[model samples]
Target: MTPELVRELIARGEALTLEFKGEERRQLSENDLVETVVCMANRPTQEMGYVLIGVEDDGRVTGARPRDAGGIDPLRIQALIANRTRPSLSCRVWVVELEGKPVLVIEVPRSCKDLCVRVRV
Candidate 1:
């Protein structure tokens, strides 16, 4: 996504199709990330949903934690979401640099099937 779009989304604040996850204090867990994707995919009204990581709940941009030494891996995130969801969710993951910080953006498409978390247990 473009930096302008990211700024627009942040300014709009959280809504049914938008969610902001702050990673200021701690790293955002994978489980939480997957859960957010599932939640957004389930929303029928929106054609697409956005989850912004490294932003505070109050809309402050902090920065996303790198999954490894390389940095935040969009491919890994896409695979994780696909593998963890029951019908698998196809999402576009990318990092948008804003305010000199890296914000991880996950775009979730509307799912025709009811998407649920795939738990091994």
Candidate 2:
């Protein structure tokens, strides 16, 4: 995605329906990953969501996966989220190479039922 696109999402911050992480670069938190999947599994109609990683504030493209965060590991991550999240969160995780770096890309489609979001205590 372009810098402008990232800026737009960051500008909006967290949505009950969609959450975006602007800090803690290079690491995809378990919570963030789950939120994206839940959004797809039970998100509102006409809503498209995502969990964007490796994208800088300036819209610069960071690598696909960090040396510490292996590209192969994200595949495992996909399985982990699928296994644990209740009602099941089916989503696609792609390791995109941006500017010669690897970044995890997740796309979630809107869901009709089972609104998959709750405020974490």
Candidate 3:
């Protein structure tokens, strides 16, 4: 999915969950991300989905353009997803820049193979 698609989802208040850093920022491990995607897919009628790590859940535009935290490479996140997921779930990762903050956008395509996935990280 394109960055625009991810933005649309956020606008609709459908896809993407804002994960914070420090407070509940339980490290973006491969298993943690995978389980999140799985839970999202399992939700009733939630077909394809996206996960964004940054913004808050209350629609508080806290990020997007100016990525503050360092060392969290987008490529590494993608690799974690690709290497840990089972049955090979197709996904798209985009580094969306909004208001100078960089947000990691992970697009998960609800697969037919399995609805439940275990946390990997």
Candidate 4:
């Protein structure tokens, strides 16, 4: 995604379709990420959901360090979600440069089924 898109998302703030996750203290836990994806996928809006990493709930951009982003394997995250959730969740995982910092974006499409649940992670 472009920096402008990321800026727009931040401007919109948290809502049914958007959520923020900051890595201020430590790396995000797999379970937390999986569960959130499930929740967003199940939302009634049926619109695409976004999980913006390195952004705080208040819209502050803490941002992920370059090394931190390098350490996060998108393929590994995708595999984890695929194996942990019931009915599975298909998502696009990518990193964008926002203000010279890495921001991970997890885009979750609305589920065709009723809901997605996290079995384990």
C-alpha RMSD by candidate, in order: 1.7, 5.1, 4.5, 2.3
* Model 1 alpha-carbon miss at residue 41, Å: 0.8
Residue runs of model 3 more than 4 Å from their true location after superposition: 1-4, 15-30, 44-46, 64-72, 113-115
| Count of backbone collisions within predicted model 2 | 7
Per-candidate local distance difference test: 0.87, 0.56, 0.56, 0.80
- Give a tens-digit lDDT track for model 2, residues 1-121: 5544544664665564445433335465667657556655565556677666666544455544452443446667677667767655556666655455555656666654645544243
Task: Please name the candidate that would achieve the greatest lDDT relative to the true structure.
Answer: 1
Error of 2 at 66 (Å): 3.6
Model 2 — TM-score against the truth? Answer: 0.59
lDDT of 3: 0.56
Better of 1 and 2 by lDDT: 1
How far is 72's C-alpha from truth in model 2 (Å)? 3.9
- Counting only residues 3 or more apart in sequence or on different chains, how many pairs clash (N, Cα, C under 3 Å) in candidate 4? 0
Estimate the TM-score for candidate 1: 0.91
What TM-scores do the predictions have? 0.91, 0.59, 0.65, 0.86
Worst 10 residues of 2 by lDDT: 63-72
Worst 10 residues of 1 by lDDT: 112-121
Candidate 1 backbone overlaps, count: 0
For 39-69, candidate 4 gives per-residue lDDT tens digits of 8888778677998889988998888533334
Cα RMSD for predicted model 2: 5.1
RMSD of 1: 1.7
Top TM-score model = 1
